[model samples]
Target: MSDQHVYLEEVFSSIQGEGIFVGVRQVFVRFYGCNLRCSYCDTSETRAGNPVICRVWRGCEPGRFSETLENPLGVDIVADLIRDLWSPSTRHVSLTGGEPLLQSRFIRRLGERVEMPFYLETNSTLPGAAVDVAGVIDVAACDIKLEESGVEDDHGVLFKRSLETIEIFNDSDCLVFAKIMILPKTTVATIMPAVTSIAEINPEIPLVLQPVTPHRSNPERLIEMMDAAGRYLRDVRVIPQTQRVLGVL
Candidate 1:
């Protein structure tokens, strides 16, 4: 991959619908590719195949993508598109993806050309990649995959990697938070280890329990999970994918 270019799925502006930053407006730059194939992944299209053209939405409106750019996109070109999509209330440039850390080099370069803080949304399974881009990241929304999420981590290697990645960003200047996607089947036993690990790292780090979209979590189960997390972590909140509710990208 060239330092000047990156594979992108799309560029748009919308409210952040996950993590503790839910409802915050942002310019979302969706990079392509991912390492993990979670059962409930909504962005599977970006996980494997490379896109031939990148969809750059017009302004911050949903479903108003009046522009399209060819891939691989130039870093400066993406910076300009982000600037064009930014509003006074836009909090940061959301560097999201199938897994943004896969293209950490491009993220570092893009961060150089953009003024807004880089908010990285990652799977938290690549510690080395995290190091490469941690300096430029302002907010790290690291995902903790549960066994029930259909991620094939037979020996817990992926979970260990996630913890390492989290530690990297936590030690950096970035605001680090752990986000666990809860399914209807997600139990207290499955989530406790992640919460414990995060607490061991820093009890001050916020934890966001995002119930996978379209699959309503059992209220009782969600409460139990929150209570369990609260005992270890200082801050815990339940958020959902509101972008789908608002019909945005």
Candidate 2:
């Protein structure tokens, strides 16, 4: 874990397949590491070290290597990278990773350099870190993992912290979307409390309930899981991995 600059696994342009930005074309910056070991993680390899080539989307061959950047990039250099990735159809930039909040300061500085809106995809476990740069970000797509994800839900304490960070961005012109991944093992009993809690916080915040992709798990179980999740989360809808469906990068 080098501290000078963040290690990146891949960076490519792709459709924003989840959250409010779903289907929107954007540049994805996938950083190299993470703190959590959720059972359903699709990017499990990202936790340890950088990979030579990254499989960006379904059917698309692994994206080839480009130059890697060290952390603490100057605002100008960061701006240039954004420009290089930019296209006429690009709507915004998505700063994602094993956990982007881990590099909050650098991400914040990078966000300051870009003229376009920036979106952050985070696990929402690091509220303190996220709050530091919440003001600079234009949108936050925070994931609130349930106990079924093999993570501790703790009566929604982690969820609450994420909401707190969302509130910080409420007054800014930024949009915040809370995402919950529903797995085969998740139950009605388990989901209601969580959905109710989110509804209580702000029902209008746009909750995205996604069925766990058929990455390492049984695909047959997805329908059952979606059925259970749908019963409780009325505002929720299913969005499978679009990249998988489209066969594109």
Pairs in clash, predicted candidate 1: none
Evaluated against the true structure, the overall lDDT of model 2 is 0.69
Kindly list the per-residue Cα lDDT of model 2 for residues 35-60, writing each as its tens digit: 78888887787787555543333222
Task: Give candidate 1's root-mean-square deviation (CA, Å).
Answer: 1.3
Cα lDDT for residue 204, model 1? 97
**What TM-score does candidate 2 reach?**
0.80
List residue ranges in candidate 2 displaced over 4 A.
1-4, 49-75, 152-157, 215-235
Q: TM-score per candidate, in order?
A: 0.96, 0.80
Q: lDDT values of the candidates?
A: 0.90, 0.69
Each model's backbone clash number: 0, 2
